[model samples]
Target: MGSYQDIEGQLRGKRKFFKQYSKIEVDDLPDDWIDQYYENGFFTRQTGSMITKKNAGEVSILTLAFLLLSHYPNEILNITIATSDFGIIALKNKVLREANSPPLQLNVTYKPPISYLSTDVSIFNAVKTGLIQPHDISSMRPNPKSSIFVEHFADGSSGLHETVIDTPSFVQICENPQKYTIVF
Candidate 1:
């Protein structure tokens, strides 16, 4: 039986370790860290999707997951893509199947949209009138630096391939559907 002080000290050490670990940059990771992440699995989040076609926004988001994992190889990762479109999920499943990767846990949840006060009425009107495309709205578009795809894949010089779906390591993880514990 450890003393209360002993337990507290252990927890404090763990907190400090995690704090430092979270601050690690991609360049700081070990040379083999990406391989380790592929072997151990990692987390990814796609908050929303605007398109679900094969070569559309959903694919970009999925690709972003790979780019993010590559960028943050120091962290443990899980994949959570939240969207109203079933097609997005289906595409994920298809990719998983094609890749033959390890079983990945997934949960599907639905939450009703929350109403919020809008001060962007003029912007909305402009879009409705076709005076400005939705993409033309600064707020509607994500900041370039903030996007994993834009940061790592858009330049075609990142050395990291954008077509992560074809990667054998990713494909291997998709192979084991029986290991998946999906919740709806």
Candidate 2:
């Protein structure tokens, strides 16, 4: 996905698909992937920050859920996106609408926002410490030079892994959806 100007530059001919919708067709995209224009109307820059309030570029929660279901068609998946953004929270209504629509059946539940989430705190700290650079903030997968140590299980298996925010890692995760999950 990209800005309208970017999509226009990539198009072979001057033609728009789903003109009324926030989507377009790009010859460069994978056959199964939908090419959507980055809708600036749905996002805003955060105060005193280079990052946008939406954070995850053009990736919508519905798209993430769809990718998950497509990757694990045989399994029952329970996907949840916790956020303090009211715009994202409002998407629950859209989720309900799509859930009731034909061809896609989804069972969705909405919960009240938690007062605080530790993960959010960690992200802020990471950004403040320069572990997550400004350029990394909007990337599909921010490959930072820094790494973090993580213990997998009681098997004593542990190692340092590249520090990446999963939610914005849509490109990498889409290539292997089963190997990753969207954390936002």
Candidate 3:
């Protein structure tokens, strides 16, 4: 998560995305991690302020569940969601009873919930469904100054992480692959 300005500026350039999206609709999540949002739909605030990519991670799990349900309904029998979001675990336990139940038809093999999940589309969907809070409303934003690399590991191969050279788009892959994911 970049600064709120950075996030808005980038999203503004791509206004087309908002046409199909809303920034305010939030998941009626519980502020108390122990109480959980899925069961109550609302909860009193306990933590100082929920921040980071927690909301994003929660949203992804919901989206993944919905997508898998609709896209591959008949073939799915079970799904093992892999995430580190408390919200995901909450929903999985409350709505899906994740541990004991399977997908309606297609069997998903996702890792179990972790504490710090990477922001992705699956989490985005959970936000859309009101399972997580809006990203901007949260108090924390990831520091872009600290270079983070997102590498895709697939097919028994390790992809490389590269340095960020420019920032009109917050980050642009370095021209030279040898630099790794460095800031300078």
Candidate 4:
């Protein structure tokens, strides 16, 4: 969490594992996911396409769920994902069960505003885009960092991810509102 480089190195290992284990080529897979193989490049003959294909459906669904959560929080909270994929099903159960999880350091609407000027305002409305992670102290905080594919939002109110906005970034953003921004 402290070093972004270390985080990327870990992901590189994970990507290598995926590349080594996934045998199915991009052309043989769904059109929606073809770009992934293009991005990952060719793998060895030892790669397991059959095994990869078997799990592909669930992975796709889970990815969809995350993207959906990113845009429409309410839709995810009110929907169902009936698939064999334990991952997707787990996420469905989680969202259906928990209504208060915050993704990407973003929390649900606070129960009450600290002041009249601040209450009931969209973080987007109040701050510029990409500002959440910059201006706010919580953005750099130790979030239970999920992969790029994982949903940033909470499945429930309690266990989503940590929010640990680091000191330097926090100080910089706080001192200059025009300097910060939100990604989503």
Candidate 5:
């Protein structure tokens, strides 16, 4: 087993990645995460959607996951995004346009969190399979840099299209706290 110091180091690294990319403060995360970029210092696109500077970075799955882990120390989060919301689609397009990259045609399971914003089946499986143990932060520490989507697909198929959190999924995870307890 690795020492506690090693595990802590990994968590710190993940946090750093999140900070470097998202630039969102853990304490300032709005309850409505989809509206996060609407604040000042963010710019609006022709699509009427908001995103940070082309270089400032948007919040990634890992960044949001780490924020949840930091704030709610005693929860196991199961993240489920609709994968077709406008906010998300815009973000993907913006990232690609800014990066001058071609359409990254990969299964949902293969896209990097930095480039895309959708949560794949792998993330859900991690919680269900106990890889992200409920209520224990330590178990998640060792693989802090690991995308919240750590578990793999069973059938090896391409995953969901990248998108934003839809109304239903967002409400289910954030609003219905009691029923969807510990889920993000």
Candidate 6:
């Protein structure tokens, strides 16, 4: 019972995110959302202009997707994705693995894509793949203005929301947690 308008709104959210972060022109956005980029490797005029091939090589759209969705917890709860890329798949895998081991009780759901996802590795992996260009990832770290607390899992694992900080890393953070905030 969902209307195309609802879907468009979500896509619009993505467009707004691109505009806000990348500083691309809103009037120059492409009409089609997912299909346009998925089919034609070329991004829109403004998008392409802002994100040079070199900068594009450094950004990952999947990372932007995760960050954008994190900001819209409500919309993510209401929607469901048919399929997702390896970045998302990887998050689910890591969360599930953590849940099985003792002392690493990650109270998160993996089946529903929106409920569980967080990690820098997934972001990096998405960059390796052609799913997203480098310009899509945000340069700004989460909770940059404040001190962020991090918890690391077994064997140097990571997730979308969990910022893993070890003893040595924690010491480095303690020096200036706010300035050196890893994630939030």
Best candidate per lDDT, number? Answer: 2
| Candidate number with greatest TM-score | 2
Report the CA-based lDDT of candidate 5 relative to the real structure.
0.38
- What's the count of clashing pairs in each model shown? 15, 0, 21, 18, 1, 10
The sequence of per-residue lDDT tens digits that candidate 1 reaches over residues 1-184 is: 3578976775676456445534566468679754553332322223476322233556556655544554554462465665433345455655444333332222121221111212233334455566766555555422221100112234443332222222232222223323321121
**Higher-lDDT candidate among 1 and 4?**
1
Candidate ordering by TM-score (highest first): 2, 4, 3, 1, 5, 6
lDDT tens digits, residue span 103-180, model 6: 333333344344322333333345455454445444422322222334355567543433334434433443442333
Encode model 3's per-residue lDDT on 1-184: one tens digit a residue. Answer: 3578975665564454333323323353235532333322222233557533334445556656656665666666665554423345456444344422342322333442223333432333344455655443123223332223444344544455433312322222332223222211
Give the residue spans of candidate 2 off by over 4 A: 1-36, 39-41, 46-59, 98-184
For each candidate in turn, the TM-score is 0.24, 0.30, 0.24, 0.26, 0.22, 0.19
Off by over 4 Å in 4: 1-34, 37-51, 87-184
**Candidate 3 TM-score versus the reference:** 0.24
**What does candidate 5's lDDT look like per residue over 53-167, in tens digits?**
3322443643454344445544633444443222554564554443322222222222323333333233444555566543443333323121222112446542332234333
Off by over 4 Å in 3: 1-57, 60-71, 74-184
Q: Candidate 3, 31: how far from true, in Å? A: 23
For model 6 the local lDDT of residue 57 reads 22
TM-score of 5: 0.22
What are the lDDT figures for the candidates, one per model? 0.40, 0.42, 0.40, 0.38, 0.38, 0.40
lDDT of 2 by residue, 1-184 (tens): 4788865554523234323332433344545333333433234344675656353532465556654554565573455554434344336456556654443444333332212222433454455565765345445234432222232444655444435434444333333333432233
Per-residue lDDT for 113 in model 2? 24
